[model samples]
Target chain A: MTANDYEIREYLPGDEESIVRCFNDVFTDGDDRFVGRDVESWRWSFTDNPAGWRVYVAVCDGRVVAQCAAQPLRMIVEGAEATFAQGVDSMTHPAHRRGLKRPGLFVNTANAFFDRYGGADRDVVHFGLPIEQAFKMGTTFLKYEVVRTQTVLGLAPVVPPDTWPAEVERLGAFDEQVRWLYDRCSGAFGASAIRDATFLEWRFSRPGATYVRLGVRDEQGILRGLAVYRRTHLVVDDVGCVCEWLVPPEEPEVAELLERGLRRLAHEDGATGLALVVPDWSPWFAWMQERGWRVHPSVYTMCSRHWVRRLTPLWLRNHWWYTLADTDLV
Target chain B: MNGRNEPQQESASAHGYALRSYESGDEAAVLETFNRVFAAIDPTFEPRDLRTWRWLFEGNPSGRRLWLAVTPEGRIVAQCAGIAQRMLIDGEPTFVSQSIDSMADPTFTQGLKRPGAFVRTCLGYWDAYSGSGPDRDAFVWGWPVETAWRIGKSQLKYEVVRTQGLLFATERTFAAGPAPGIDVAEVASFDEDVRELFDRVAPTSRCIAVRDAPQLTWRFLERPGFTYRIATARRAGRLVGLAVFRDGSFEGVPCGALCEWLIDPDVPEAGHALAHWAFACTLEAGRDELVVVLPDSRPWWMLMQSIGFRVRPTKYFPVARYFSKRHHPRWLWDHWYYTLADTDLV
Candidate 1:
């Protein structure tokens, strides 16, 4: 089929079945990032998010061939609440990979998605944590800029530090204390996704995703630190990923206590070690290095396309309290 | 053109402005545009004087470079200036530049498109001064606060050397550690002997400003509307170390800053003695904290951290555009030893 045969348009109500088929066909069968895609998981990401979808598709006579879209995010920009978009599910079927002689179906569909959603009025900026080649193309053709090189800190399993009591327990759901904890922790960032109970409740409730929520409590049984973990063989190795790590930078003792408990859990889950993400500039980076956690280069690079003038490249780079939980990859 | 030998002019129609090199009489116009632009955006900006402007742009002994963007009405709306310094990079003498007074008036550039007049002005400046050439600077850089940095990397090819970290002493008082036998003395001006001290310390860094007598005089001594307490540490009548301090405010908060600190690598005690003196002087000034920036990967970081200081990264990335392999950013990152005085922002 020629590029003229493909029609690029927005996502309709019944596009999930063909979109999943297109995704499975586009991605390698046993790829680490995309082991597989099912209709149920696809719907959970696209339609079930509270912030809604920003999807676009290329249709050739009712057959999906390429798709590009984002899962909307509610973020606080320099203390003022705003909505942001995280670009995801970027795929193109093998048969129509190059578009032969013109701008491809994937490019057309991706442009349609960005044209619909990329702006300050819509989501401030449309960003993604894409691999290197995608980042280069996005920067060259689509006006994307590097935000940060994701830095992941890793340490092998060890006995818990005995200086403080590691009394963390499994939490069933995020509560009011988690919201308060987020409020106290957000001051350390220039910008970040809103980690309130409303967002977390919807974020962690994805289908077929298993996560262990752990929290450390105070004498009054108030949650002081929280960590969301999953022991999986990631792109790197078998490790307990700290999918979400939330605690005040000022309270290193509380962070250590929670970390001690996670190490125990990670060891019990047969994980090789615990891997956590902390920006290289953060005080927590030094804390982790002091505790013998070495920084490993990550495959994902954070990039963004700015539609807002005020949210300049440096403003976003310096301010954002970004973490793995902000992206759909985790 | 004015027909009276005005600065060399080049057509810059991309933003409805003309670009030109600096001439002798352009100081007042440049200063006016700088003060006006900064006053509009930064409330804490202190108005600059013509004498300081003349001394800043014209007084550089190594070299001076300036460019301005002017309207058809002869209004100087934007400027790209560099106060150049001589340095020994990769075993050869070379010139490096630090940008000061990078400005673009909002009134003149309100609705200009992306890669606006200000960004284009900077690009024009870089093309003339940086990259491979016999007379080109090793690299030109600026400690852009935010707007400049944003417009720079997105438009101009700015590669960040590092997101510099600041070390702040928790308490303003001196530690109870034993004082070294080095004799610390306050100096009225940097004498010719200071050059010798800098030469001894130059080998420790790969790309460093040759901080000799001329640079120090223009940097700290001759600067207008500011005073830095310059202290020198001597061992057996030999200059072993130096430190400069200022009582200042940032964002209207009363603060103290250690502007410059350099000690001989072989004489670690001299660094301790200087640090102790800085702490005691700041304590006498009743400051809450003493802030300074140093590469955290350096030996000085461990020395300062041991003196009850904590390091936190600042958003200020000292970005650069290089011309030669001698001043590559990788070499600069690991071996560029600089202090607050090196940048014009402070």
Candidate 2:
């Protein structure tokens, strides 16, 4: 039969079992290169609708063949404004493939949908595809313009008690204040508006993370600075992940305090190094650069779909790197 | 966390509007106003039925609060909402206030043109009550890019996390190509032998796994607000492949989602049969739109293109972290097939 004999359509109510069968047939054995599957993920997919996201299917000749889906792009970027779409799971049944020509049908179908519903007035449709497909499709990679990479700095050797700062008489009081400050500013990234108290109770109180938090206070017991670090054994060796470090934007000696505090922790804990997540434009990065902190190779890219006029200049976009630890789930 | 003193109030005139707590009896008016507003934006927006409204206002255990800006005539022109919750920041205790579902009267759209004014009003409400502490942050989860741009200038910073793309099968180019070698079957029931074939092949598939009975039943048969269809392929009475789809909509666009498609790797031709079957099902159902969630990987894209699925330039940021760092490396799975609007995962 010719390809015209086939047709494409939507998934019906009873298709779940057959769909599962098709999935199992294609991926007969799970790849060991990846982590084990958590059934909860699948459960979540079937339920939970914070935003009204949707999915679609392709059928031909009364049989299920290819499928594609989309969801709302929820994050905000520093500048530029546009609604975004996340394209997920586009695949064809193996038996239906008539060579390289089949995948084009899928792409053509998706593009037609976008052109009809996306509205020409929209600024840009943003999504991440594989680097190879991106090249083939001629879609611009937002990371090239929006992302900033930096070499995260690790902690230095700790100084002895004799070398502690002269005004460090009230370190205990300082720690409390720093902790208090962190409680207030935790959800700046918009994942959740949960306040500091709940965050501390849930994350740090747990044991598996092996995190140690510290505070640098002034003589007046004001919380001027704070940092949270965790011990982790990387592929090569044990290191510290600086989950957080916050100082008042106005602090004059913030850099010196971070240096001394980190050094002391490293030496006391026998840590080989400490990896801190900082905004690309952080002053601590420059300080670390001067102090011989080695810069790693990978840079985390942040992209957003927003319709607002550029308020924060492009130059200031790299001012911060919110660490994974700062999020609620991590 | 100790409650701090309230923040200094900014001049209401500076914002060109007054912000206040939503009143109890304003629910109906607010919902009506929003429905009208969205209808102006897009006629297809589904209004909240009474049951859905009750769920939003009373059924939810999360103590969410709503605020609105009223016109001089007592009409609710603008509205915003917040959910009080806690999140971690740098391993410290933090409280966050999440904002969502801000809407304004279409007639006053010109007055609301100052995006910064609305944002300031919303944030001022938070700071005045919640206080800016280390852990206290304000969040907006799903603001459209245009809306984000209008108000993102002030204290709030915007980061784009996930994007959705759309595809339509307006033309059937696959019909011009050669046909598949295997037989594609459409069965009304998944029998024992079919189940056995599925179980045997599921453990090896990339996107489909053998789900527990509870999950299978709940996701497919038990879920409300969606119509699901399944199609399977068999060779010599042994199940070799299957594909699934859900009848749904996206923001009002009638569509069908290809939720899953799997075939034995040994019998690659089964993949083609599944795609052809799925496409025909979509057409028969009279749905014009189709969507899929694929990872930023190559092999899956190639498979999709080979069978008439077009790529919509979009990406989804599926945030995942290992529950325990010591357990195993984080694995990125490209398993999401097409999804339906009513599906909860989105």
Candidate 3:
């Protein structure tokens, strides 16, 4: 279809099913990377998000032809929490193919989405870990500036600390202590996703995925650190995917104890090593390297569009503490 | 045309401290501030002597430009300096500035309300040396440590270019050794052979420093305290590859790094052969692995990975400010062919 034939507008309450169909058509047709998105997961990602959602779709003959969507997030920016959004589930139907003239439906839909909800008044920053092609499009048309290239650090199974100083316990649910530890941990970063227990509950409640939570408690039985991991064989071959490993940099002993427990946890799953996603600026990136972890460039490069002057990419480049859990995919 | 103005000279005076371009006799004061500032931050920092300082700054071939914040009594309180680089961007002679030793003594900044002596001194240097003009640098760049990076990003408009990372190969699998008709040998000095080799490789690079014989000799061969191993790879008697290595330690673990590598991309085998040699030599020298830094967009990135080199993020985040619209941050990052030799740290 030509650009004139399609109508692009903000997401409506009932547009979820058609958008998911178009997304699945564009993604699951031949690409091994996607398994075809379901409407329930789409709801859980955007519609059910506590912060909010901003999505736009291209309508052709009453069926969704293309879509651009973002999952709203409440992030701990500086010291206070602010609303942000992560660009996710962007796709266009192949049946329409190229518009063959002017700006196409996909680009128009994306532009409409950004115009509707981008900037400080809406979502302060629109950020994502886009694939290379999407990143090029975002930078070329959507004014997306690169934040940094991400790397996944891998650590081989290692011997745990002989005498663990803290009690390592599996967390069946995130409690008030997780919020306290998250607040304390996020203080070290200029910007980070709000990791309150509510976020953890919604984040790890993936329908089919089992998220393993390990908490480190000090001698007083107060939670000092928390780690969340899961096995995603499709993601990186039998390696445990670490979403969050939060302990203050000053609490190295607690981090060490948490790591020891996580290593044993991952080893129990018959994994070769544990793979964690962390940004370059995170102190843990260097910490992992110092501990003999092997780091490799991940397939995704982080890009962001800053609307508020407060969170420029330059400031975020040196300060943003991000991990796999910050992303919608994880 | 898009970058900020970099005037030939910049001066600022405030609260009993004056910032100006380095004069001949100001060397001692500047050197003292540099050593003292660095030593305070790093306990193991080796104090640079006058000879080494002169060789690094004054003896540079392109030229020397250092700005120092000095008291009225001529004691230097802060300094911002750059080791000039003669680079070839898109096959044109381009003057770039590589900032080094940006330091300020706490004693000088203690009573200052805001924008202390260190920031002021660096501003003078940056204003006079960077941005767009016939005499100005195409860009000013540096690998500032984490603390300095924060200040630079916030105040000096230093955009993040790329976070520097190294290609480390811990286990060599005896692959892609010297091919037939290819020979590798250590060279005592760079000469016409190295110059011609660079001439052949220059056209293929979007951005690269002019690493001719004299430049190589100045950087790796004649540099004062470090003994660097310069190796050449010859294919059927013509120089096709050049590599330099410095035996050093990373985080107290004995390791060697391939500091510089230049070879034609068409002859990927030459690079592979040179890498194999470097890896073997590093292991032989009692180092566990060979580490290197190269832009992942360069042709050699995949080749290095194929041979065994794995990527690891470094402590450095490469930052730069560009003068021309033709040269954006990503443009420099994706095309620049640089290694550790491009930096002063190695």
Top lDDT prediction, candidate number: 3
lDDT of 1 by residue, B1-346 (tens): 1111233368757577888777667777778888888898888788988888877877767677787788777778688888877777754666778987888888888888876677767777776666554356778887877667766666776666655666777473234243467898888899888888988888887767778888888899888888889999899999999889888854355667889988888887888888777777777888887778876546786567656665545666687777665554444666777888787755
Can you list the residue pairs that collide in candidate 1? A190-A319, A191-A319
Compute fnat per model: 0.09, 0.00, 0.32
Q: Give the worst 10-residue stretch by lDDT in candidate 2 chain A.
A: A135-144
Model 2 is docked with a DockQ of: 0.01
Best by TM-score: 1
Winner of 1 and 3 under lDDT: 3
User: Model 3, stretches more than 4 Å misplaced?
Assistant: A1-45, A48-70, A73-126, A130-147, A151-300, A303-330, B1-14, B133-135, B172-174
Provide the lDDT at B302 for model 3.
59
User: lDDT of all predictions, in order shown?
Assistant: 0.75, 0.45, 0.77
What's the best-to-worst order under DockQ?
Answer: 3, 1, 2
How would the docking of model 3 be graded? incorrect
Cα deviation of B99, candidate 2, in Å: 7.7
Report the CA-based lDDT of candidate 3 relative to the real structure.
Answer: 0.77
TM-score of chain B of 2: 0.46
